[model samples]
Target: MFINNTWYVAAWDREVGADGLFSRTIIGVPVLMYRDSEGRLVALEDRCCHRGAPLSVGRREGDCVRCMYHGLKFDPSGACVEAPAQGRIPPQARVRTFPVMERHRWIWIWMGDPERADPGLIPDTQWLDHPDWRSQDGYIHYDVNYLLIADNLLDFSHLPFVHPSTLGGSEDYASISPKVDRLPDGVRITRWTLNTEAPAFAKKVREWAGPVDRWNIYNFTLPGILLMDSGMAPAGAGAQDGKRDGAIEFRGCQALTPETATSTHYFFAHPHNFSIDQPEVTASIHQSVVAAFDEDRDIITAQQRSLSLAPDFKMVPLSIDAALSQFRWVVARRVEQEQQQAAASATGARPAQTAA
Candidate 1:
């Protein structure tokens, strides 16, 4: 579940164009996002107050979005600016507006109380701005609870078996042990082994970039944002010679927004060295990664279904799953805290539980 009072990835930068309207769900709340004439971002409840028509179906007019059912127009702040039929705005006719911001090639939306909206609350990513790194962007839809994806990402032990043909089937998997440090902002930074049997790509890195020692790092920010290192060695340098040494590096960010208790929308950003200077090479890398993602989608969806069908499913986890277990507890605690806060607000009482 997404933490309350946090910014979640709503859409890619290029997805929202002039006069474009996109509707998405965050934490089970439907939101409508659009761009104004001046290229400013705005978000509001997808539901129109009038007869419950979806405002996302409305047409864009200047800085306002007009309801298709009636000609009612709403400003960026969701204030009812014009009512074509009444000629005067009704006091209670306004729709709720949400605070939004654009950063790091993504549009972020506030899903909790509007008063808690703070641009600084958004996760920080200094790596994205580094000139030495290149980035690619994409999205994925998961047919499982978002929390599971978060767990999967926090642990890399599954890589050896789940992604054998991809980046995992290497000598590094044998001695894999993650070093995790929790940050003051509730984020976790983890660095783990990355080369086992040193894959073809690692070999390439040794050849072109000199002696290679592979390690993967992940910075997981609260409410489902992960920044991971995606650089790998080239072929023939770390492993046997002339063995199709091309490897794809995947440093990127992922945001898992809950569509419901059972589904999630995954926004991913992958940056690699091979495609840093070439647009064509970048596009090819994106396609290849997308195919791998499709493989993951199939596996995760099946796991979700099977888990849902089980009555008392339980699996004993090894040390490698520690990060995953810790992440799950963090998510569970955050969700519980939000629920307690909401209950307390309803009764005007002190919160029953506080953050640890």
Candidate 2:
């Protein structure tokens, strides 16, 4: 089950034009997104109150959307202002408007009660707009459950096998164990591979004279958001001892938004702090990331296809699955808490059991 009382990334900031409307199905709800005349981001249910037509196909008339099917106009608040050929508008002629916020080049929408949507809950992704870093927006659609992608992010062991050439450079990555800490909302994973061969992407940005010390430190938060600090330095440079004097650093921000039960919207960007002047470095880094993600997509898609054949099959876990397992528990616990709260609101009772 999906958690409803949370914010989900709906689209990139550049996806919606000044005078255009963007539509997408988020968590089984079709949503229409656009900017009002005042440049405010607005999100509404794509379905119309009358005749059930999609408002995405309608025309914009000065901050209002006019349904082309029968000329029903709706304001940014989702209220029907004008209904042609009808004397008075019906009381139930308003569509649902969701709370939307545009920050860090990502458009986020509240999928639950509007009153509970706090802007402070959104994660920080300032690296996308920081002057010291250089990066471009990247997106990819996955034909698997968002949780599956989340599992991939929490477990770095797949890097050696799934992305050996692109992201993981040596088999030693699979042998090395990472430190995992469970957080209130998610989990934090820190891994360091000292005196190992540098990954292919790191070699592309700058020439590495020999084997280097690599590190992947990241936080995988609730609702599938990953903020990471990953990089490489020359071997025996005291990188493992927290010395970053001659290291190349990269910041990765990625979001996984569910489009359906078995589909996901992936938004990502990897910004570098070492080469802000050379645009080619940024371009090359983006290209390498795309290639590596393509590898992930292929394997995950196959895994989904196999799982679909046996819906009730239970799998075994290993030591490497600690982070992913804990993350799944966090998601499940949050979903259950939301369900309990909703039931309590309906029946006028307090929830008793708390997830551990």
lDDT of 1 by residue, 18-45 (tens): 7679898877888998888788888899
Cα displacement (Å) at residue 90, model 2: 1.5
Which pairs of residues collide in model 2?
none
Query: Distance from true position, residue 249, model 2, in Å?
Result: 0.5
TM-score of 1: 0.85
Q: TM-score for candidate 2, please give it.
A: 0.98
The Cα local distance difference test for each model comes to 0.72, 0.92
Q: Which whole-number lDDT from 0 to 100 does residue 90 have in model 1?
A: 80
Model 1 residue 11 CA deviation in Å: 0.7
